[model samples]
Target: MSDPTTQLTVLFMPESAHGPTNQCIGIGKVLLDRGHKVVFAAERSWEGKLAPLGFVEALVDLAPPDPGATDEAAGQFWIDFINETSPEFRKPTLEQLASFVQPTYQALIDGARYAEPQLKAIIEEHRPDVLVEDNVVAFPALVTSGAPFVRIVSCNPLEIRGPGIAPVFSGYAAADPSGWEPFLAEFDRTHQETWEAFNAWVQEQGAPPLPARDFVHTSEVANLYVFPEELDYTDARPLGATWHRMDSSLRETDAEWEMPDSFAARPEGAALIYLSLGSLGGADIELLQRLIDVLGTTEHRVVVSMGPRADEIRLTANMVGDAIVPQTKIIPQVDLVITHGGNNTTTESLHFGKPMIVLPLFWDQYDNAQRVDETGYGVRLSTYGFTDDELLGAVERLLADTELRARAAATGEAIRSRGGLRVGADVIERVGLDHVRGRG
Candidate 1:
């Protein structure tokens, strides 16, 4: 057993995405309060975000880039890569979808190579007891660190795989298991190609080959899932014993934000709808404008968070548009949420007992949207080829459906009943300490 007073140094290697970063913050705070030293190996921009939380931040460039480029160059390379591979530009075919994600898999390879040296330096300097990794990217770096590592699934439970389990990327529910074999076959092929390419790169770097086929595989120590079990497809297919599901890792924020004047001043009995496409999905100006136009015509008062593209759009009298809104503050007041199916947004919306119309853009968003629809608490709309009428109809249905509202409320209560942040921290601390003592 480890000394109770010993302050173990815990390190986190989270992907640069907003959802993963936010989750790191949530878990970091809990561990910090438990008298542990927390450090984050993230991008330079994350320094400001971690500083206020009292975490020691080691800035590293982990962005996936083109071959033979410096980390700084890789940052711009990723921007260009995203521009070229945005889901808005891709077709709905399985081949196109697979092609669209190839760059992401390649980026993980690039990021691992880019981050390995910095991660090694951090490990040598800090001598962390355990490394907690968000199971999206940076697997190569984590494996090379020579420290016990814990995996956290901050998004959809993709790492939990077994027979009869639907493909992680497929938006289909587990109930209809028929006719999915071909898609799963194609998905497996794509996954194998990604794994082979990454393995070859790791070999060239003189790193040991990964034991698993993909980056989403669970860690041997422990894998912490931040989502509730009700939202997962865990019926017949059982996850590994090391896998643990805790409640949502949503951190409470004290930032004060009021509803926009247009929304606040809406006529009595008008429905209020909050629309956010997350940080990445908001870049599609065409989709944003189409959503704005359609929702603006509805009797409901709409508030749109355009993320970085807020300045490019125009808002009408019944609508409000901003670069970013305090969604935590707005979610409880709204009757329904229109989102791009990002996990944070999906779980937050459900936690607040608000119904949603999910327009999944890409990645785990599709799976999350599928879960929402399957649970009878929300509706799903295709981000590609969705007409204004379809968007309006989905929103209207969610808003009017009393049964869906009841289901959402019940689900929210169930999720809240499960210990949230505290439970997640307990698991992390226990696994991390056990690993540290075992190493000794």
Candidate 2:
């Protein structure tokens, strides 16, 4: 319990994207409602989103080659690259993946450099008692600011590193003991190159050296995983003492949405499939059209969130495409979700006991898709080399499978029993207050 006499000021710094931004807002709302002062530091454009939440906002300027570029650009680049190589998986060699991620890495380094002074100014001005950071690109700035902070793992469980676990980017399911050696070797080689480059950049920026690891892991008073433990690689590999697995940090909004008139009047027996490719994945017009064409033939009512490219696509009577939709509101009404397997969408679907057909494109989406299949709650489809028949078949199979829905319901119950939002807030308040009191 918090002391009534003391009100802690908390600052949240999340990378400028929907997933990370939403996670921060979920926790920040809890903190604000509990009588503490909450602030958010992100790109200037996000101020509109943050303003409605009533939190004090601080905007940071990311450095050049693109001055004032937001963190969303990194994901946009990945989307553009995927589209350029569409209809076929560009399985870049390890060296090529390293080269591909370099510009994004440099952008992070530059952002951190620019953010250091901005964070220092905020710290000096607000004198926040604790900093809550979405573990994306702000670690260097947090460490240099000398502020006690908590790291939130909004993506995969890459922190639990060891020999038996599969590499995050490989999209491979957890392997048997004998089968993991080769994957481990490749994991080490790939990350070694990445860390060498990142650490070199850190030195150039005059920040403290980041510890070398197979993936980005930071030392913190408490590291919160905003995902169920069931999605983790394997129970055999223990998450060490410092880690805490919390329920999904999805904030429930009071705003309500009704189904589109066309969707509402669809045949009663038809299955409802909510198809979203996330903010980044929806950029591929060709891929979106292909998916729309394939799903249109099924006896399902398809609702697509086309993001920025919604106007470019044509829809049929069986399909409804919108530039944006209240996904949280719609996920519950749908029978099945066809998605890019993003962490936010994956967890939300699990929370509502909805089965999914996961079509992963890049990053941890592949890892999330693998877990969905491994957990028996969904089926995984390859984003590349899949025909209309394959896409239609997977959807038909998932919608018709009774056992999959049962598994999804069981997992959803387990997650809700853990006390979703309260579990996360309790950890944050206890650890954050302790650190402020110098008892951590």
Candidate 3:
């Protein structure tokens, strides 16, 4: 429980992306409800978005604007990068280490380095009691600012390695470690120089050194990852006392959604499915169109969150879509989901008891997709190579599987009833307050 009396000023620095920022919003709401101050530190592109939600927005640019660029949004640099390297996503994960992962980390490292001076300035300006970050890389200024800091792992929990566990980015199965060595070899080969340079720089700024193969430093005070109990991998490798698992951290802030009259007017009992590739995945118009064509032939009605290229793509007669949808609101109303296995969508689907056909594109998405498939909560198919039947069949089968649906419902009830939102908020409150008092 929160003190409800001691109102601590807290600063949140999330990677300027929707997934991590959304997770922060969920927990931030809890703090707001309890009368604590919550502030979100982000780049200028994100200024207007957070302030409306009652969070104090502290905007700091990671880099100056490009000479010719006009439109701006959170993680715009990454959005452009992902689109430019879309072809690399088609390659095997092993091959991607050199082509994609290394460069991605390099960009993140550059951003972190450039933002350090600004981060230091922000800390001085805000003088927060606690600082929290939901990011893949470390920001030394947050740790060195003399405030208690918390780490939120909104990615797959496997990102945190342990004994007997598979390597972080590899989608290899836990029951079999045969593939782990090659993946680690590739990761180290591609990232060792980059990691060492960043690690050295991090230590120079008075923060702890990152582990050999990791980018972010674990918080000594508290660390939290979003994952349900049934799906967590603690049996293989535990993160010990300071770490906690949040079954799901879904926000309550999404606008209410209702089935469009076109779909609502359909005869009762018609199956409804949602197709979303997330922001990055949605930019692949060709792939989205192919999926839409196949799903159009089914007896199902579809709703699509089409990302940035929605205007360029054609939709089927049975489909309605937008560049973005009220995803949390839409999930509960759908029987099935065709998703890119992004962390937010995967956890949200499980939280709503909706079965999924996961098409993983890159990063920990592969991990989420494989876990859902192996754990029986959903099915996974290759993003680039699945045949129309392979895609449609998974949808048909999941929709027909009463046992799986029942298990999903029960799991979702447990996840919902316990309220991971509240759990996350409570842990943060306790950790922040305790650490601050200990310092005193």
Q: Per-residue lDDT of 1-440 in model 1, one digit per residue for the tens?
A: 23467788988888888788887778888888878999998765565778788899887876543367654454454445446667544465356446766666777667776777877788888888888888575455566567777888888875466677766667777688874687667766777877777777766655566656455435777888877666776776778788888767776643666877777777876899888988777777678788888877877888788765577787766787687777777888899999998888887787778888988878878888888888776888877778888887788777778887887888878777775766777777887778677887
Model 1 lowest lDDT segment of ten: 71-80
lDDT against the true structure, per candidate, is 0.75, 0.72, 0.87
lDDT string for model 3 (1-440, tens) is 77866887888899877888898999998888889889888866676888888999887777766767656543465567667988998998899899988998898888899889988988898888888889999999999987788899999999888778777767778789999988998898999999999999999999999987899989888888998887889888877898988999999999999888878777665689999999888887788989999998976899999887778778888989898899999999999999999999999999988888999998899898888989999999989999999998898899889999999999989889878988888888887788667877
Q: Which lDDT tens digits does candidate 2 get at residues 1-440? A: 75666678888888776888877787788878888888887766575778788789887766534764555775466567656644334463233334444445556656766767777787778877777777555445555556577777787765445545766555676654453555556555655676677777665555567655522436557777777766765475676676777767777643566887777777766888898988767887777788888877776788888866677887766877687788888888888998988888988888888998888876677778888887787888877668788888888788778887787888888887876667667677876687677844
Q: Where's the lowest-lDDT run of ten residues in candidate 3?
A: 69-78
| Ranking 1 against 2 by TM-score, winner | 1
Q: Which candidate achieves the best TM-score against the true structure?
A: 3
What residue runs in model 1 are displaced by over 4 Å at the alpha carbon? 1-4, 63-83, 87-90, 144-146, 200-212, 260-265, 436-440
Top-down TM-score ranking: 3, 1, 2
Global CA lDDT of candidate 3, please? 0.87
lDDT of model number 1: 0.75
